[model samples]
Target: MNLYAIVLLVIVLTLLTVSLARLGKVKTKADYLVAGRSLPAFVLIFTLLSSWIGSGSLLGGAENAYKHGFAALWQGGGGWAGLLLIYFIAPRARKFAQFTIPDLLEARYNQTARLLGVIAILFTYTAVVSYQFVGGGDILHLIFPTVITADLGKYIIAAFVIVFTAIAGMASVAYMDVAIGLLATFTMLIALPILAHHAGGWSAIRTALPASHFQVLGDFSFVQALELFLPTCLLLLGNQSMYQKFFSAKSEKDATRAVVGWIIGTVILETVIVAIAVVGSVLFPTGEVHERPREILAYVGLHGFNGSAALQLLGALLMGAIFAKIISTANNWLFSPATNLVNDIYIRYISPEASNKKILAISRLMVVLLGVWALYQSQHIDSVLKKSLYAYTIYSAALTPVILAAFFWKRVTAAAAVTSIAAGTVITIFWDTPFIHHNVPAVVSDRDAIFPALIASVLSLAIVSLFTTPPTPSQLKPFSEA
Candidate 1:
């Protein structure tokens, strides 16, 4: 397939996404933030699936599969664990009826806690958005070398993301996701199998690849696996984006059912992507695809299937699906943080007396600011998976436990909550500092921000609660009774 044609197809699809977003009426704070809290089961399921699977899985997961084989499944598996955890908590989160994760924390803790939590969410979520932009730009650069030329491609890609996201908030993001999620799933499941069969069979794939590539555990030792395991599990426990899906659902049953579907969808789709990468490694066998493992889907689509017309169509669909996944994820990550800025930070602090109209206006403005910030940061980052881990760690380590305690533990005081959150967040930032990362030995130094953050949060919660006074009977009544 010609690169020019592919670039044109992407541009057209992007325009269609923008057009659909404009059709929705984004008048209220609820509409802009959570689709008016009226999404049915199907929409909620796809939105959750699409938002979670984004550039990280399509590009970064494939990259990991190429480099480390089946071990990459651990990263995808983390979300499955998180969804199960969410199943038990979704009803409560939905009952809270709040706009942001910080809102729940503030209700149980204090304003200071909310402020700190917002700062952490914004920093990390913005970084996640930036890396998605980088991944999309890489795709554009690969397909249309002239349009996304060496000097200007980054700017072009960033500009498109900013414009699309700034158009209509979650109103736009949700619908786009539904369309893309279907495409992405079909692309991987249908296309990859045909490509595999054409390249010979499962037998051919096994014989062609290194023996180690087939091992489920890959090269990771027990300790190294734990390093990957803990952070992912912690992040899953309280992911803000997942909560956003809960808030958007039409009802409790819809939210719960959607998440169940999400688990099944993630397991199947992620496994297929990994399988595609393994097949690519076997057939290519020269590491020629290493520089852009994310493009393996495209490479297989364009070259691997020889002369079959049906196979070619499947390949195109798969390629299109990967592109859809990138855009949908980018849209959600870019939009959700803006909701936090408006509902939790801006409306709370900047103008507490502001009307809903003014709040919605401010939300749109912040979306532009955040979109530009994401674009600027996109230039320096390289890997979607790494950026995602950093973002997830910041939220999971610092905020998840604190939020959990808010609903489940009546003894949790504002001071204890604040201390735990602050300590966890500070340690996470310190662990990621250049000096700290460089000085630590490779065996001990993996970028598991959740480690220090979760430890500090837990210790701070325990020690502070033990030393300080617990909430009074009146103060504890609401949570205790509920």
Candidate 2:
């Protein structure tokens, strides 16, 4: 096998061993779903970092950087902005101590709101998983271009992620993330400077690319950049996977501390990712990567480190890290929606008295089913950058408003929360469709869904809550008093 393939094999083997070991620990619903609510701050930090900086950064954000340069940070900047707010919200999220964001919604709002939140999560998280598969396929194709095509690679990655996620659930996903996160963080950090050196440094890069590539907004308008920023910010604010990590913490302090580390790691790693892609764009200005910009990072991991034997080794390890990061992220996202279905929908509504074993079994089945769904979706996705934004918009516009209101706005009524959720979800889903585009005025149809969906959601929430009866002390107690 080639060096990249060998490194990938080693990573898969290590992940399998870890998953199997954790699988033996899964004897209860909480164990399988939330790592027995006992992950320490250190483990939580890496898991959060690994989960957040996935295909969205390595592929989609890199694609943006390749084309528009430093402006891609607008996407990463959104999460950084959200993380600042999350530092205060982390302890509160742990205080709520629920398995899913829907749990928090049900606790703070009502069952109908919880159901809507679950619907939004299912659509949003599954698409997130799909692009991770797309990214994984790209990695595999880079490593074994002669043997495995991207389409075939998608099936292989889907199977691997499904099996890994189903084996030990959250414990496996989180622990594996610790390893994958370290690999990626260290590899990318080390690789960037060397790649820059190979590319003749920042002076060379500035000379090689367009002037817009170095600008704040690059080639994009303020509206286009905002379109990138808002979805990412909204998604991070209401991210269910993140809340699940908080719920899995050993203590409120651990959860809060983890966010501090998570923010630092996210900032360092995301900036490094964009910088590497910027360097890669300088090295490979045209040809295959020019046609498929999302593959730039992997292309760099394969070609950018060929200066010496040692650098080639680093390149191979970097490829391994990218592949492993994609799997780690897919595991987290796939397991999250399964938790939603099991904890929020199945246990809460369908099988309240289900044995731990039955719930565990159903959870695995859900992972496989969702993996298949994500794989199917992967086939239809045209662009990772657009797909990431689309998925982010769905959750951000639909759920972020109601979620934030639950924690911060006591006057937000159940009726208003439900209306807001419905308004956001429906509008985001239809905003880009042919029907909306043709029927709606150009003024409305031309803009992204975030503007209209968020506007509708916020307006409905405020207007309805103002007209409707305010929540009672009991209804507000879980969020306010917790």
Candidate 3:
């Protein structure tokens, strides 16, 4: 194996070792699902950072930066906006202190709402995991082009992530993220300046690429930018993986403090990721990367550092960081929907009295099933950029409005919440289908799913809430007002 391939193999083995070490601790549902609600602020910060940055930023966001230069920040900017809102929401989420978002959904709304929320999460989180698989495959293929094809790499990544995630659940996902997060952060920070200098600095880059790349919209219309912005913003505002971290926090203060660190980490790392991609664009502007822009980050990691042995070693570590982050993210997104199935559906309905061992066993099984499902999904996706937005739209449009309402709007009834979630979920799922395209007005069908789904969600919520009876104070007591 080459140095890059060896580095990646070592990173994967280290992560597996950490996961196996945590396996003995998974004795209870809480221990498996939310790290026993004992994660301190420091652990929470990196886990949250690692979870949030994932393939969505490293590959998908990097693709955007490769094509649009600084304007790719539009995607990252959406998260920045969401982080600002989450700063106010984290303490409230920790105060609620539940294993899953569905727990909070059912507590605030009805059991029906909780069930629908789980459905949305399954579709969304699994899709998120699928793209992480794709990114992982891309990394492996870049490292060992002769030995591993991207298609085979997908299965390899799928198996490893499934096994690692099933081993210790959230404890494994959370603790491993601490190391991955730090490595990715420092590697990106150190690599960006070096790559920029190697690319002949900012002036050369500006002269080589189009002026539109430097522009705010980057050749996109306002509506197109909004299409990119809303999904990410909405996804972050209602990301279940993030709220799970809050529930995993040791205290409300820890959750809130973690968000502060998360915001700083997210802004810097995402920006640096994009900056690195832009530098890579200048270095290798065409050929294979031009066709598969999503691989730009990995391509840069493999080829960006040249000249000295030290630089070559940095390249290997940078590639390892990308590969590691993809695994960390896949574990997180994969583990989340499994928790929903085990905690929300199985425990709530099928076997409330099941032993801790049985629940743990079932949780791991769900992870394996879901990993296979996500792998199947990875096969169908042609672009990581489009897949990221599609998955984000599923959760953002279907769940975000009602989730925010549960805490902010006293007049929102369970009926309205159910209606809104249903409307958003249905509209987004069907928006691009052949049936909708052939029958619906071009004005509506031509637009991205986010607009119609979000409008339907918000309008259904407001109009229905106005017509229906308001929520009882009893249901409202558990949720903290923001």
**In candidate 1, how many Å is residue 187 off?**
1.4
The sequence of per-residue lDDT tens digits that candidate 1 reaches over residues 81-197 is 777887777777776667788877777777898888888788877887887776666666655666665226556656666667777767677777777788788767776777677
Error of 2 at 432 (Å): 1.1
Model 1 stretches astray by more than 4 angstroms: 1-24, 437-443, 472-482
For model 3, residues 1-482, the per-residue Cα lDDT tens digits are 67887888789889989888998887898999999999999999999999989899998999999988888999999999999999999999988888999998898899999999999999999999999999999888888888889999999999999988999989988999999999999999999889989989999989999998889998888998999899999999999999999999999999999999999999999999999998899999999998999898888888888779999989999999999999999999999999999999999999999999999999999999999999999999888888899899989999999999988888898999899999999998888899999999998898889999999999999999999987888898887443
Q: Please list the residue runs of candidate 2 whose C-alpha ends up more than 4 Å from where it truly belongs after superposition.
A: none
Weakest 10 consecutive residues, lDDT, candidate 1? 3-12
lDDT of 2 by residue, 71-119 (tens): 9999999999999999988888888887899888888788999999989
Candidate 3 overall lDDT versus native: 0.92
RMSD of each: 2.6, 0.9, 1.1
- Judged by whole-model lDDT over C-alpha atoms, candidate 2 comes out at 0.92
